[model samples]
Target: MASTEETKTAQVRIQLTTRYPDIELPDDPGPLLVSTGFRRYALSTLVNNLLQTERPVPFEFLINGQFLRTSIDEFLTANGISAETTLTVEYVRALIPPLHVSSYEHDDWISSVDVLSGSSPAVREAEEVSSGQERILSGGYDGLFRMWNMSNEVIATSNAPDEGGHTLAIKSVKFISPQKIASSSMDRTIRVWDYSEESATLTPTLELYGHKSSVDSIAVHSQSSRILSSSSDRSVGLWTTKKSEAPSAPENLIPKARNKRRKLSHPTPSKTGTQRGPLSLLTGHTDVVSSAIFSPTDHTVGYSASWDHTIRTWDLTTSACVDTRTTAHPLLSLAAMNGANLLAAGTSARHITMIDPRASATTIAAMTLRGHTNGVVSLAADPDSPYGLVSGSHDGTCRVWDIRSVRPGVGEVGGGQVGESVYVIPREILKEKGKSKAPVGGEGLKVFGVCWDKHVGIVSVGEDKRVQVNKAGDIIRT
Candidate 1:
């Protein structure tokens, strides 16, 4: 019998295939024998050699929907795969990993982040500028929401506590328009602000008070001026940014008991705007509703993810919950991938689950992405591609994922296959002062929120009180 090394080096048969329209291989090439010792780089070289192109193109290989991160021999042994079986591998253009660009410091933990650039609703497409106009909106545990320019200067900040600003830690923030913003907080309310870029000022315009408990997150639809909020009270509230469009608060919906306001150093601005209420309350979640967002393709359709381990689809026009898909772990964050007709949910189990919320979808889940070492707390869909996604986790790392590269789950989760991240982005040390010098994987490094802007790249906030920016590489369309 041959030695262990020789047996491990034995060749295996593999069928090469690609879904990419541009890349093609010889028809009926049959199976090609390759050493089981081949890793990703070696396999990539093989493909480039076959193509015989002037310049070698890097490619990523996928077997069974999972990336080929290890040598063929190691992977086969670990999965108990037999060499006699012909493995079909899919190849696609490799994505360049995003590099750390810059970071902004905060007084306390940053909870949520969003970037506003020329692509925002208020900014006309014709007047849209790539640089200088980019603004960053961040909410923090310090009970203040701030607006920063591309130069990392604080252009505007929320009003004083007495002036209708958040009385407690802000949980979420979003730009309703270039001139307006909406924020939700543990103070049991949502607040909209009027921002003046010329004067670099932020003013409290409206106070939305109706949630019985802390408001966890908020999403905005600028076209319809609609806002969706998820709360600890287990309900999703619907409202409009335009004051005149919303109705009065119903007496029955407001709770009899309320959270006591916390005292602050600055005198509150004396409640500047009219207090408004939600147009409708969609209730069904048995636990805290962590996130809510309107469908990208249809404004009337909405979805909410809750700690109850379920994602509920709603008919917003009727204020009805149309369907619910249960998962194995509590969901902490959610993002819409309408281009792909899917919703991605970040879970406490340290993985992101992609669900097919469409009524005609045969399975509850399309696939599961596994990589994060801690709870996945935030998710942002790549604005350029439906299959592209990024997730922030308590493990102090952000992972970029391509849902298309996935493998079958073999029946562990209902209707769930599995995949791994395309790139792993880690927290970087800021060269500027007042930044954390904590080592990689240090404590108190949990990433709380993340958002991907087409113009500004990826922005993520974490317990380290830093708003980190990473410049994503150009997409190599295959």
Candidate 2:
């Protein structure tokens, strides 16, 4: 018998095309080229070898005087010949040419989430220090302003006499120093407390009573000792502490109820009386001033949001109104981000608007966020990450948003135009689903305030009358 290699003789064929008019080729080439009684064997031997080696096969094949480089896979797929089809080497080469092949895979998603504590507090506000530590200060119908340690434990609590019982309750609290805390109450006074000793003692440091109505909010300048307070009287007052020889008296600057309930007619100058008053009254809002805050980067610049349906920026140095933008709805909360150049304002309309103070104070609706179902009452910015912001709403939840993702470029989107929302953290909804059925403590949990701690992530307080600490991916129990 003949040797196996010699017995398995492979067929080889070739064909040339030069504009042939009358030629009938095989209906199914099957890796073979046949035309006008001419049979061309396929080139399967070289193709099989190249495919097995996982390499490209570059071979020149002639067809009608034109040369081309094609791959065996492409030639087979194009000719309706599948893997099961077997053809000789010459027939494959005559029917198709060898070529190079490239393949690619699809892109995948790489994003994740982190849930934190929730709140349903009547009022809440937080302040971060030059140090990385954060101070969460909040109050509600409970009539007490509680300060929590970074661990979410109540480090100190400031409460007035039960007789006083915080008549209107503590609306807001701020930290002027690590040992000093300032708060405004519905009782129409601003009290400063000192934590110098082991125990936290409440001292009536300053009685800012120019406003005839309840004091709504207060903000301390990062650089100066000046304090800015807004009130239901629709006025902003700037206060400065001074040392006096005689003992100071705590007095209600407002007149008795018999007198007209109008705002204080005469301005109260600083103690020297020679210099203008430390409390500069800004009078432009038609309605109550909902919130006021100093610029994080520039002490001379301040911002205020009001129920008057407008947001105003102030040049504190000149004590003049810098610019104002009227909104269709009342602004309930305001926060500054991106080194104080970006201002985020949440409205009663359940929409958040971001404004570039560096710009012409134009409203950038594109960057607006609309996730809260109810009115937003509180707004806080992440001190460590200016692009990160947390907002608390009467809707009983706090939303965390990443400002950077809202737009493509940095300066301003579409020349002061707003970009769409990027990310939102529905903290309240998450907490409700995670709560235990049986109450372990005296009262159930509810979130009142939401704040970002540089080291601890987000800290919050609620009607549950407890402070809860939350990191991005996990919730830290105090």
TM-score of decoy 2: 0.58
Q: Which stretches of candidate 2 lie over 4 Å from their true place?
A: 1-135, 150-153, 162-166, 243-278, 359-366, 407-448, 473-478
Instruction: At residue 472, give the lDDT of candidate 1.
Output: 57
Each model's lDDT comes to 0.84, 0.52
Clashes per candidate, residues 3 or more apart or on different chains: 7, 31
Question: 213, model 1: CA deviation in Å?
Answer: 1.1
Worst 10 residues of 2 by lDDT: 103-112
lDDT of 1 by residue, 1-478 (tens): 3345975679999999997757777554778999988899999999988877678888988888667878888778767899889999998888778888888999999999998887654465555546767999999998999998888888788876866688899999998878888999998888889888789988888878789999999999887889999999999999988889878655554334443575323322227547678989999999999999999889999999999999999999999999999988999999998778889999988888889898898887788899888888899988767779999998888999888767668765785778788788777753343555434443688899998887788899998899999975666643
Put down candidate 2 lDDT per residue, 245-352, tens digits, no spaces: 222332346323332476535433322222223357788989989888887777778889899988788888677887887767888778778554777888887778
Candidate 1, which segments miss by more than 4 Å at Cα? 1-56, 61-91, 119-127, 250-270, 430-442, 474-478
**Lowest summed-lDDT stretch of 10 residues in model 1?**
262-271
